[model samples]
Target: MTEPADAKAVRAAETAVAAEAPDGAGASIRAEHLVQRFGSGRGAVLAVDDVSFELDREPARIVSLVGQSGSGKSTIARQVLGLQRPTSGAVTYGGKDVLRLNRKQRSEFRRNVQPVFQDPYAIFNPFYRVDRVFWTAVRKLTDLPNKRAADEAIRDSLRAVKLQPESVLGRYPHQLSGGQRQRIMLARIHLLRPQFVIADEPTSMLDAQTRRGFLDILQDFRVRYGITTLFITHDLSSVHYLGGDIMVINKGRIVEQGAVAEVMAAPSHDYTRLLLASVPAPDPDQRWTERIDIGQIR
Candidate 1:
């Protein structure tokens, strides 16, 4: 497939930025001893417990944080995106603390590190046309000279995600299908061409086929645009499909970490094993025989 016009523009912009930046400028997002606590005294809940990981910028790849719901996976993402400050520890981007970045640095960080959140419906305004999202992004994040340039960029971005511009541009959030709305978010990412993507359960709301397509696009971004992703999810099937490094968190702790294939083949932690076993088998002839005690893992 031919690269989209907007993609070409992003490539040119990236090249320009690379030329001006100094050597060893490919910095990573690092979380050191991260801890997030909510409430107080005996009721205080430790959402994240000493979670430490590094998302490197070189050789772009997907690193999945897998766990059950309320397992601190999303909390870690919030910290990484500077949406919420950790109670203890730090989230640093390019060797500087994310919370402490200056205006310029913060702007650059926001541009370079973007998010694809879980709920597509919640991302847009029902009161306005869906095009507003793209227009707002163009106005704030891009230096497109005029309305014509912005329009072209938006059209090309929609095309890049396999959405026809005419069908999607003027519709409200309620007018589009779930998959189309999610792909619109992906198109936004394609337009921005961010170095890192914080995809928090981006495919959970899509159908099986749509979910696969979404994962394929993420892989393509890594291959074509070098957009590394921190894929946060509870689905072991999705984790196995998007094969990369895997970190298994259970009860606010990283119980196991390794390559997806390796960990899937021989999971060291019981929680990891439970997650893998939970994945439904494709063949009806294969019966699930393992009995799990929920209390034991906890």
Candidate 2:
């Protein structure tokens, strides 16, 4: 997007958000019977099959979407981020249909809803300085009088993500480590404080230690700013650590969903049970095995 377009989008978003008074307690993001299919007729493939869920933003929370590859997790994430249009159903933010939003509404949605994809490098331009993303965001997201004020705001946001300004400001994307890049993306999101955030495999690339810290960062942001998040991943442990509801998807359909404790204790669906069992146990004597008979269940 051009700088002018970015500025316009930010302005429109701010206006729309300001126009609506905070209702305080309600569903912030909702997906109503979403279905996405590729191709048509007999050859059609259902990428997301009749999925529905809600991410409550009023009190701030994390909602986990867990599924292995090809289980429709990423497809659902794309739909929620407005990156893809489902063949059926709708995704709404504050009761506004995402697919049918007007230009102004689109701007508001753009500002209020943000996404962090799995690959951090994919989100940045290698030619530009790493800090360019933050600077551009500040210019478009806020109306600070001059560059100095924007720079200060940028520094503050960087600190929130534990990034030192001088260390990364002049570096190119290639110069930074994968973890650093991911943190930068988080910092960008923190600066915006969007109403809803969609994170898809955000920590999959990080080491175990880094992944734990990354999850903590997300938790900190949630506690500090009351930002709602939809965390998409294949890791059940991460979901358990994040502390939110879990939705298990299989072949584009949500087979089971409920509070973390309830579902983890006793998963009803075979797919869900299989997913939980797949989590490795620390004790060698307690190694997990598929306790369910998948053939009979399906």
Using lDDT, give the best candidate's number. 1
State the lDDT of candidate 2 residue by residue for 1-298, as single tens digits: 1123222322333443321323323537889999999998999999998999888776788888888777787778778877678899999977888878776566667676777767778767678998878876766655566889878888888889888988888999999998998899888888787777788878777776677778888888889988888898877777877877888878888899888889988999988877777666534333222121122223
Question: What is the TM-score of each predicted model, taking all chains together?
Answer: 0.86, 0.85
Model 1 segments more than 4 A misplaced: 1-25, 280-298
What digit string (tens of lDDT, one per residue) describes model 1 on residues 200-256? 888777777788789999999999988889998876667777898999998889999
Error of 2 at 42 (Å): 3.9
lDDT, model 2: 0.75
In candidate 2, which residue ranges exceed 4 Å CA deviation?
1-27, 282-298
In candidate 1 the C-alpha lDDT for residue 71 amounts to 85
lDDT of each: 0.79, 0.75
